[model samples]
Target: MHATHSSGKGRGHGGGRGFRGAGGWQQADLPPADDAAAWLTGRLPDDWFVGAPTITVDREEIVIIGELAAPEGSDDNSAAAAAQGRIGRFREETREARMQIADEAEARYGRKVAWGASIGETKAIFTHLAVPAMTRLRHDERRVLDTLVDAGVARSRSDALAWCVRLVGEHTDEWLTGLREAMAEVDKLRAEGPDL
Candidate 1:
């Protein structure tokens, strides 16, 4: 409930301690270990939560210094560490849900997406351009994205992403006309099955 400016290096403009009242938010100030127990129920799967301990976000880098004390010694691996680190950062259901969507998109379309920068660049594309949502596309055109999603012909995630964006770029206004209905149709298709 409080924020003390993170003393990250390079004291350029805003360097050093500034305090906020208890109503502030700090990424490092996470729920207690027990509070994070439900983090197991999140997408990454339970064992992947690494130590399954609560997390706090401070220091230039916070160290999660423990691995599982599994009797079978199967606990030491990067996968679990990655999950805990990934899932621990979600602050609410909306963020967690968005993360889930992005994660799925990354996984299916971008398994090779290594760092945040790449994902961020993709985000920047959407930020700068007027991209279309499912609602924007025609009933038949939605087939394009679905087809790509289904065939998996795009192979890597980036390829799939670029294809969808390209489709949007070609018909931005068409999509904008009946966005709500389009979205509903797409959502229904999504619920019913994967893309064609």
Candidate 2:
């Protein structure tokens, strides 16, 4: 049996276009994460093993992370290769379907959407973040880095700090945006308000 799961967090408008689902596939208002997962599962072939997906919404993008497995009973070497090949073919064949899903997700959440999958084991994907060269951390901040290292979330103190920064960025994205807008409004008011 094939099953899929998905989880996502974001703000949504009331209406969106029809999203394809496992059965008849229906149009709904603000389709939840489970519905999205079912829709994606329906698009995949019967042989694929799709794991639970973690979805994240950034300013302009929705990211989907999940694991995919080869068809069951394909343990032999040749069968394993064939299964891998079929997985690749599935990805190619479903390109348009993926785009459709992305479009629907973007419309529903008001953001662009991109997806990435891992065939088996999930590995960390890294992106570089630039910071000032002369920056220094306080003693307490250094202890926090040490704690993260002790927790094994990162390989080193620098990595631990980077992970912490990334976590903060992910969790506070919407709040940061709202803060920026509020600041912009405050600036406008300061400039345009009646001079004392």
Candidate 3:
């Protein structure tokens, strides 16, 4: 069945010509993928998902998560297992097609593409990119990560820092949404400005 689904909440980013780096790409140089959702929706096979996948884009990666119909005859206790089986089957069946699409998307967007599928209560990300993010923390901030490592909450400072970021993101989603909206507005205003 043909279904219409959205990528996710759209957020606009600044647009302009930027310089590229050797072996790596600068965020400024990356092409704006404002139409990524529409593109994927059109490119993906109609029978692959119940609806359009939710596509999330960042400077380094693009994640596409799609929902699959849950298998029948699954009880509450077995739902997760059934969903997992369905997800695994989908992954194996779609691997070749997904890779081809990822290749095309990466070439077009200059960012890695990851795929995920969800059915019932289970969601599985088949492939993902782990791009290192460099950050400099003050002594106090560094100590906080060290403390987490020492407390066995994380394996290392990097893990601790990632944990902290996820925690903050989970708690401040609403605030972050507002911030993104404001940034989108700024991008809109900037785009309306004179050509330089």
Candidate 4:
């Protein structure tokens, strides 16, 4: 999923130092996104399935986002719980797989590559709650949030900002979907080209 911040800056550097692992791999040496996706797909258990994976290169990590497939014949509640449990049980295996990928990435990119995964619907399988993070906002941005609070859309500035985010997401669901699809395609194309 594309993360949005009021500052219009992404959380991590795209295609920068983070993408290159310190071990020796440079950006050019890193495997193509498609190749990484295929490896992950093959490594994961058949029972623990996922949709097409999208790879994101950040300053400190490589994130693979996919729809974690729910167990068949289960209701939403049971399916979610089951998925969580399964993921928890396989954490070690997942880490090993990620390390293997990281090794490859580091060898090729000349930097350390950290890997992460998200469950179906892009929900983090491990983190249970939203942790507080600090970000500096411009005067006008803060003012806009305060105005939203005054308007009664939320109880506080933070809540108001969250409300606005949800509203934007709801309204631009289709556009977001398209953007994700486009990113996947770009990954595939990058894989087909020469390394780097």
Number of the top-ranking candidate, with lDDT as the measure: 3
**In model 2, what lDDT does residue 49 have?**
40
User: How many clashes would you count in candidate 2?
Assistant: 0
Candidates in order, TM-scores: namely 0.17, 0.36, 0.84, 0.44
Q: Clashing residue pairs in candidate 2, if any?
A: none
Give per-residue lDDT, candidate 2, residue 116.
61
Candidate 1, residue 121: Cα displacement in angstroms equals: 39
Summarize candidate 2's per-residue lDDT along 34-59 as a digit string, tens digits: 34445555554454346556555433
Query: Could you tell me which 10 consecutive residues in candidate 3 have the lowest summed lDDT?
Result: 1-10
The C-alpha stretches of model 2 lying farther than 4 A from their native spots are: 1-49, 71-87, 122-196
Model 3 steric clash pairs: none
RMSD of each: 22.1, 15.6, 8.7, 8.6
Q: Give the runs in model 3 whose Cα sits over 4 Å from its true position.
A: 1-26
Ranking by lDDT: 3, 4, 2, 1
Worst 10 residues of 2 by lDDT: 1-10
For residues 1-196, what per-residue lDDT tens digits would candidate 1 score against the true structure? 1222365432233544332212223322432222222332343444432444332222121112213322232245554544344333322223444355445533433221111101111111111122232235577765665677779767544456677666775878566546645644654565577533
- Give the poorly placed runs of model 4, Cα more than 4 Å off: 1-48, 58-60, 66-69, 72-77, 106-122, 125-138, 147-196
Error of 2 at 178 (Å): 21
* Per-residue lDDT of candidate 4, residues 1-196 (tens digit): 4334454233235433343322223333544443544665565455534555555543344555445555467677687677666556555556766667667765644444443445564345332224354667899999999998888878997787778778998999999779878866775675578875
Error of model 3, residue 60, in angstroms: 0.9
Clashes (candidate 4): 18
Predicted candidate 3 versus true structure: per-residue lDDT over 26-86, tens digit per residue? 4557877777888988999999999888898877788999999889998888899999999
